[model samples]
Target: MRSDYKELDNEKIYLVTGAAGFIGFHLSKRLLDEGCHVIGIDNLNDYYDVNLKKARLEIINKYDKFKFFKIDLQDKEFLEEIFKEHKIDIVVNLAAQAGVRYSITNPDVYIQSNIVGFLNILEVCRHYKVEHLVYASSSSVYGMNEVMPFSVHHNVDHPISLYAATKKSNELMAHTYSHLYNLPTTGLRFFTVYGPWGRPDMALFLFTDAIMNDKPIKVFNHGKMKRDFTYIDDIVEGIVRLLNNPPKENKEWDKIKADPGTSSAPYKIYNIGNNKPVELMEYIQTIEKHLGKEAKKEYLPLQDGDVPMTYADVDDLIDDVGFKPDTSINEGISKFVEWYKEYYEV
Candidate 1:
C-alpha cells in the first residue's frame, strides 16, 4: 500500500456498484488493500460469466472491511436499502450493460441497465447526500468523430451505437444532478481497458482464447483498427486518485462558449486512457510474442457499432489527477497472457 492510502480517512466508506465486474473487482480490491471500508453490490448477471463474477466476489469476501451485496441497480428499493444501511460517502457507479454489438440486438437491456439503473444511482446519491459520485462513461461516446485523439471538449451528440447513446445519457443525467442538487460528480471516459480478469468479450481476451484453442481470430476492419489500450491497474489508480479529489465548481467556465467537459456546477469529465494508440496488428503481434503462438486470422469488415480508430487525449487527466495511463501494450499483454495461462493451467 502507498503512503497516500494511509493519509486517506479510513472512516470514509465507499459504495462500489458492479463490484464483481472486471474494473470493479480490481478497484474494490485496491481500496480494500488500502484499508478502506468498501460496500460492493453486483447482480452478477451472466453478461459475461457468473462464475467469473462469483470468483471476484470470493476474493473480495476475504477482506474484513468489505461487505458484498448481490443486487441489481434497477431494484431501486434494494439499492436504497444499502445506502440506508451504510453511510456511504463516495459512490462509484460501474454497473451497466456493457457491449456495443450486444446493444445492436438487445437494446432493452442497455436502456434498462444503463439508463434506468444509472438514474437510480443518481437519485440515491442525491437523497443520501453522498460527498462525491464517480461513474464510468465510455470512449465509444465519441461515435463518428474522426479526430485523432478524442478530447472531453469535443461534441459527442452523435452517438453511433445504442450502447454509446446510453453512456452519453448517463453523463447528461449526472450533469443534471450536479447542477440541480449541487452533487459533486466526475465521469471517466475509459478507452480500451485490458488485463488479467478482463471481460471475455474484449478484444485481447478473445484473441488470446482463439489462439490458445487453435481457432481462427476474427480480425475486424481488415486489421486497420487502432485503440488506446489502457491497463486495468492504470484505470484503478486513476479512479483512486479521483476518489478524494471531487470536482469543484469551475468558476471560470463560460456559459457563452460552454465546454462539455467542465461545468459551473461541481462536475467534471476526464478521458482515462493510454495516450498511445496501438495498431490492431501490432497489438496482436504483442499477444503472439507473449503466448509464443501464431493466431489464425480471419479478416472481416468493420463492425457496425465500432469505430475504425480510438485515440484518447488524456491531457485533462494529467492536469487534474497528476497522472496518465502510460502502460505499454507489450507489457500489458504479457501480464494478461501470463495470468490467462496460469488461470487456465495451460
Candidate 2:
C-alpha cells in the first residue's frame, strides 16, 4: 500500500532552520514523509546532547528528499546562497537559543541566535520574497500576565525572562516584515511541548533521567507550578495544518477595534497548547507511575527567569487551524516512557 503522502513538486523547496533541534527535527521529518523537498539548516550546537540530534538526523537522512546544511543562521552571506539556490516556498524558523534558566546565565547566545540569527532569516525572506514564513514563539511571552488561560490579545509587555523577550521580539519582527513587505507570516506560541525526541533540558526529561539514576530531581517553586504541556505530535499537527492554510489579511480588520491575534497585514499568531494546565507534582507522580519508582525530590523556590505557570488559550488555533491539541498528560507520558525505555534500552 502507498503512504498518505503524494510525491512533492520537486520544483518547490522549503527551508527549515534549526533542523537538528527538537521541533525542527520533527517538522523536517514530517515534510520529508509528505515528499516535500526540504532544505534543513542547523549549527548543531552542543546546547544539548549532540548524539540525540544526530539520531534525529539519521532518521531524516533515510528520506531522499532532504538536504541539510551545517550553516548557522547568523551567517548572512550563506543565507543569500540558499535563497538563491532553491525556489523556497516556505520558511519555518525554529532555531533559537532555548531555555529560560540558561538565558539568565549566558545572555550572549540568546542575542546571537535569537536576535542576530532571526534578523538574518527576516532579511533573507524579505529579499527572496518567500511565500510564507512561520517561526516558533513561546508561551513564556505571556509573562507577568495574571490571566489563567493566557490569550494572544492580552498585552505581553512584561517579559519575565530573556528567552521570553526574544520570542516576543520574534513575533514583533515577523509582524514588521508582514506589515512592510507584504510577507505572509504566522508566529506559533508553543506551550510546554514534550514528547519523543524531546529536549533534555525540559523538566520531564530531566526528572525522568534523575529518577532512573537514583538522583534527586529539582522540584522548582516547591512543586507549585502548572504548565499546558502540549505533546510534540500535537504541535506538529497544528503546524502542518496552518502551513496548508497560510495566514491572510483580515479584510474586516478594524484599526480601532483591533484583534491582536490577526492583523490588517498578512500576519497571525496562535497559541498551540493543550489548553489544560497540569500541576508539577501531579506530572511527577505520573512519571513515577510509569517508572515504578518514587523520585527523590528536592524542593526549591522559583528560579529567576522563570514563571509560576503557563496555560494557553488555544481558541484561535482551533478556530483557524480547525484542530487543537487533544493528547492527555497520561497518554503523552506513557508514550514518552515507552520511548525512553526503548531508546535507552533501560
Candidate 3:
C-alpha cells in the first residue's frame, strides 16, 4: 500500500543491496518515490544478462534521492565504507547468487556470495546499529519437505540445493546476530516472485521468451509442478509493511519446544506468498493466452534441485502485516506480457 510508504519517515536513509536486481530495483524505486533517501549497492555480476541489470539501474539513477554503488557484498571494506558514509536507518539485503539449478554446477559462487556476502551484511548491520535489517530468503529452503503448505515454523534443515542451503544459512545467521548483538532482523521467505523487470532465469521469463519465439519450452516433471507464483507488487507491499515493524523479543517463545521461525531474541521469519499454488501447465497457458502464441512443450523428468510443488502458509504474514497477496496469475501474466512486448517490440 502507498499509505505504508507515505507514513514512513522520509528522513530515514535506506540501503538496498542488489539495487540493479529485479526485487532490489523495484524496492529502491518504491522507497525513492516515497521521498526516502536510498543508497543502492550491486556487484553488477553477469549472473544472467549484465545489460538487463544495467537497464534496471538506468531507471533507478534518474531519482535525485537515490545513489548507486557497484560493489560486491563480499567486499566488506567497501560495504562498511558505505555504512560509515551514510547513517543508514534500514538495510534490505537482496543481493545473492540466485538460481537453484545453477548452484548445482556452481557451488563456489553460492558460498562466496550467499554465505560470505550475507555474513558481511550481518556484520555491518550489527556494528552500524541499523534500526532494522530485512533480507530475502526463498521458499526453496523448504527443500525435500513434502508439506502441502510450507510454514515458517517448519524445520528447513533438509535443503537439497546449495542455493537453498545458503538462504537457510542467511536466516540462521540473522537470528544469531539478533541474539548476540540485539540487532533487529526479519527474513522473508519469498515464493515464485514474477512480473515485469523480473529475472530472466526464472520459469515465467524463460517460458515467455521461448513461447514468443516458437521454441520448445522445457516442461519439467511432465508439467505437473506447482508454484505459488506471487506478483512483484504484492511482494513489495508485504516487505514495506514489515520494514517499520522489526521483530521484538518474543517473551512467550518456548525454548523447550523451539519455533524455528521466531526466537526470544529480536528475530522473526515469515512467508510472503500468494498462498495459492498453480499448476505449471496452467501458468504456461496463462502466458500463452497473453502472448497469443502456443508453446511447443518438451516433457521431461524432474530436474536436479527441483521440486514438484510449493505452497506457502502465509497466515503469519497476514496476521502480522494485515496484508495478503491477492493478485491472480491471469492479471499478473497479462501485465508481464504487455511489458515484454513493449520492451522487446515483439
Candidate 4:
C-alpha cells in the first residue's frame, strides 16, 4: 500500500529522539547515508554505558546533514525550541526508559520519560502539524496472552510490567491525538531486537559478555524462555518502509468489536518481528558456537515482569510494507560476537 504522505525527500527534516540509542542510532545513520537531513536528539543517559552512546554519536556526527541535540524528551521547552528551529516533517520516538525488570524499581524514570515525555512529543506534533509520528512499542504489552503468535489485532489490556503499561499507554495516547487532531500515528511493537551495537541489558549482549569473561551466566525461567529475536537491520528496514506510509482511519473499523490494532482515526499498530521463535537454550548455544566456548549456566526461576515466550504475528507488517524480518539467529549472533570481540579488544 502506498503512503498517504508525500514521498520521502532528502530535503525534508526527520526528528529522531533517542538517536544515540541502539535502534535510534542505526536508523539515524541510515537516513544520513541516504542524504536526508536528520535532527537527532538524545539525553545520553547512563542507562547502560554512556560511552557507548557517545561512540554511536561520534559515528553519526561525521555526516554533514546530521545534527545532534543533547536534550531530554521531558524538556518540553527544549523540544519546542527544536521544532521551531527545524521544520521537522516526521518524528520517530525511540527514546524511553526501556527494560521490563528495570521498571520494577525505577518506575519514576519510566513515567517521566515514556509517559510525560511522550505527552510532550504529542503536544508538539499536534501544534507543529508534523506529517507522521512513529514510536516504539513493545511485545511485553502482550502480557498474560497465551496465544501462539501475538497479533496487533489481539487485545492487550493486560500488561504485566510498568514498562509494558507505559508502552500500551503510548499507543492509546497516539490514538487520541490521531482521533482528535488528525495526527497520523503508527506504533511498532518490536520483538527481541539484537545485533551489533545492541543494548547491553538485552540477552545477546549479556550472555556474550559473561561467557567471554568466563563468568557464569544467569539462565532465567529455568532456561525455557522463547523469543522472536529480530535483527537490527530488519527492524530498521521495517521502520523506513513505514515512515512515509502514515496510518489512515480504517473505514471498516467496527466500534462494536473494537479491534485493538486499528481505529476510525489515522492510527495503526504493527508487530515487527522475525516471526521465528527460538528457545533461550538454543540462543545461548548459538552464541557459544560463534565464540568457540561454552558458558557456565546458573538456572534460575523467571524473574519479575518477564514472560515465558514471545512470538510476533507480523502479518500486518508484511501486508503493509511488503517485508518481513528474515535474519537467522546464527547470522545475527555471529555478527554481534564479531563486533563485540573487536569493540572490547577481547
Candidate 5:
C-alpha cells in the first residue's frame, strides 16, 4: 500500500448562492483556497453597494478554481440550467433579501427572494440528489423570545418581523425535505456577524463609514441594544468545518420528546455566534477608538422588526465541532478600521 493514501483531494464540486455578498464572498474564497471547485452565483443586486459586491467577486474569480454565474436564484429556468450542468456535490444557499427594517417596506421582495427562491433551490437539490445542503438561517428568528441565550432547541414559532418569519420558514421547509428525502441538511442560525468585508447595511460597517465622514450614525434602542457580535473569520471557520460533516441519522433522537435541534431524519440546526453579547454603545466606542474619530449620534427607539438584545448559546457548536467564535470585538473592529482607511484612501 502506498504511504500517500491519506490527504487525497476531496475534489468537491460545490455551488454557492449569493456568492457576491459578504458571508458568501468569504465562504467561497475559503473553499477556493482548499482546492475545491466552486461555482459562485449572484444577481449583483444594488441593495447596499454594487461596487463592493463586484470587488468581492473579483477576488474570488482570480482563483482558477472558481467559476462565476451572474444569475438570480428566483429565475427557475436559469437556476435549473445550472443544476443540470454541474455535478454539484454540495450547495451553500446564502442568497436572500436581508435587512429587518427594509422588509417592512418591501415585503413582496422578501417573499419573492427568501420564500419562492428558496423553494426553487430545494426543488433543484431534490432533483439533482445533491449530497449535502447547507443554508443560512438568521438570529432574527429569536424575535420576542424572553430567553437570554437563544438556543436552537427553543420553539421559534413567534417571529416579530416578516423577514424573521421567512427565515424561520426556511428551517421548517428544509426539515420537511430532509425528512422525506433523507437529504442531509444543516441550517446555520447566524448571530450578529461583523468584521472585514462586512455588509454596508450592517451596524459596524455603517458606523465606521459615518464616523469617518463626520456623519451621524443612528443608535437604535437608545443604544441599549446588545448583540452577539461574531467576527467574520470565526463565522467562516465554523461553516468550513461543518461543510464536510453533514448531519447523520440521530439514533438517540426521541420522537416522543422531540428536540428542535435534531430530527429522525438527517437534519440539524446549530447557532454560530460569539456566545457573548456586547452592548451596542460599547461596540461603537471600539470602532471610534480604532478610527480615532467620534461619530455624530442620533439616539432612536427600537425600530420595527428589531429586538432589544440577542445572545446565542453555542454549546452545541463547541461540543460537536470543537468550534467557538473566539475573535474579540476590539480586534475585529480595529481590523475593519484598518481596511476602511485603506479602501477609502482616508
Candidate 6:
C-alpha cells in the first residue's frame, strides 16, 4: 500500500466537476464520507436523464460536507468566482460531453464542453495553484490502435471520434500547463466503467433495461467485441489513492524515445482499468444470468466510431497505487441488477 493513503484532512477542500455524473458522484460521496469538504459542480445537461442526475445529487446532499453548484465549466467568470470563494486544494475534472455516437451529429457540444471547458479548468487550476489536478481521460483516446492492452506509453495520435480527440487534446493541454506553470497534473484513462448507478447509455444498463422489458439489445461488432469492463467502485478507489500522490518531473525521461505517458514536468497519465478484458457475449450472459432472462439480440456491424476491442494495461497503476480492479463480471452485474430493480421498481 502507498504510504500516502493516510486520512485526508477535513480542512482541505476538493472541487469535483460533473459531481452529478456517474464517476464524479461516487468520487464526491467518497470524499464527503472521508470527512473532507467537497465543492461539486455540474450543469446537469440534458445529455442524459436530468432526473437521474438529480437523484445522484440527492444522495450527496445528505452529507453536510458537500456543496453543489449548477454551473457549466465553460463559464469562466462563474468558475473563477467559485475558486475565489473556496480554498480548493484539488480539482478533479470529470465533466464532458460523453458518447462516441452522439458526437457524430452533436460535434459542437464536445468542443464546447471537452475543449473550451477543459481550457477553463486548466486556467483556474493554474491561477489557484491547486496542489494536484486530476482529470478524466477515456479509453476512447486509444483510437485506431490494434494493441491488445492499451498503455499510456503508446502513441495515441489517431482518434476515430471527436470525443476521443477532445480527450487526447486535454492531455496535451495539461502537459503544456504543467510545463509552463509548474502545475501538477494527472490524467486517468478509464476503461469501460459500469456498476450500480451507472449511465443509461452504457452497455450494462442498456442491456439490463432492454432485457427486462423484453426489448432487443443491440450487440455491436456481432458480439465479438471485448472490453475491460471496470466497476465504478474500483475506479473511484484508484482516484482516491492518487489524490495526494501528484506527479513529479521524471528525471530519467528521454526526448529520444518520446514516451507518451510521462513528461519532464509534473505531468503523468495512467490507465485505470480492470486489466482483464471480457468478451461482449460473455458479459451479456453474466447479466442475463443475474436478471434470469436472456436478451433479445440484434447483432449489428461495428459502429463507425466504435472499436472492436479495448484492453487496458494497468501495470503502472498497480505499481503506483498498489491496487487493481478485480471485480468479476458476475458480481458486478448482479449488483447492477439489484440496483436497477430497486431504482426502477421493476
RMSD of 5: 3.2
Query: What is the lDDT ranking, best to worst?
Result: 4, 6, 1, 3, 5, 2
lDDT of candidate model 5 versus the reference: 0.90
lDDT of 3 by residue, 218-319 (tens): 999999999999999999988888888888899999999999999999999999999999999999999988888899999999999998899999988877
Preferred candidate (TM-score higher): 2 or 4 = 4
Q: Say which prediction, candidate 5 or candidate 6, comes out ahead on TM-score.
A: 6
Give the poorly placed runs of model 6, Cα more than 4 Å off.
1-10
Candidate 6 least-lDDT 10 residues:
1-10
lDDT of 5 by residue, 241-336 (tens): 777777888899999889999998999998999999999999989988998888889999999889999999988777777778989999999888
- Would you estimate the TM-scores of all the predictions? 0.97, 0.95, 0.97, 0.98, 0.96, 0.98
The global C-alpha lDDT for each of the candidates, from Candidate 1 onward, is 0.93, 0.89, 0.92, 0.94, 0.90, 0.93
Give candidate 3's error at residue 232 in angstroms. 0.2
lDDT of 6 by residue, 123-221 (tens): 999998999999999999999998778999999999999999999999999999999999999999999999999999999989998999999999999
Residues 164-218 of candidate 4 have per-residue lDDT tens digits of 9999999999999999999999999999999999999999999999999999999
Give lDDT tens digits, candidate 2, residues 83-146: 8988889889999999999999899899999989999999999999898899999999988998
Which regions in candidate 4 have their CA more than 4 angstroms from the true location? 1-8
Superposition error at 8 for model 1 (Å): 4.4
- TM-score computed on alpha carbons, candidate 1: 0.97
Model 2, which residues run further than 4 Å from truth? Answer: 1-11
For model 6, state the Cα shift of residue 6 in Å: 5.9
Local accuracy of candidate 1 as per-residue lDDT tens digits, 13-93: 999999999999999999999999999999989989788888889999999999999998999999889899889999999
Clashing pairs in 2: none
Give me the candidate number with maximum lDDT: 4
List the lowest-lDDT window of 10 residues for candidate 4.
Answer: 1-10
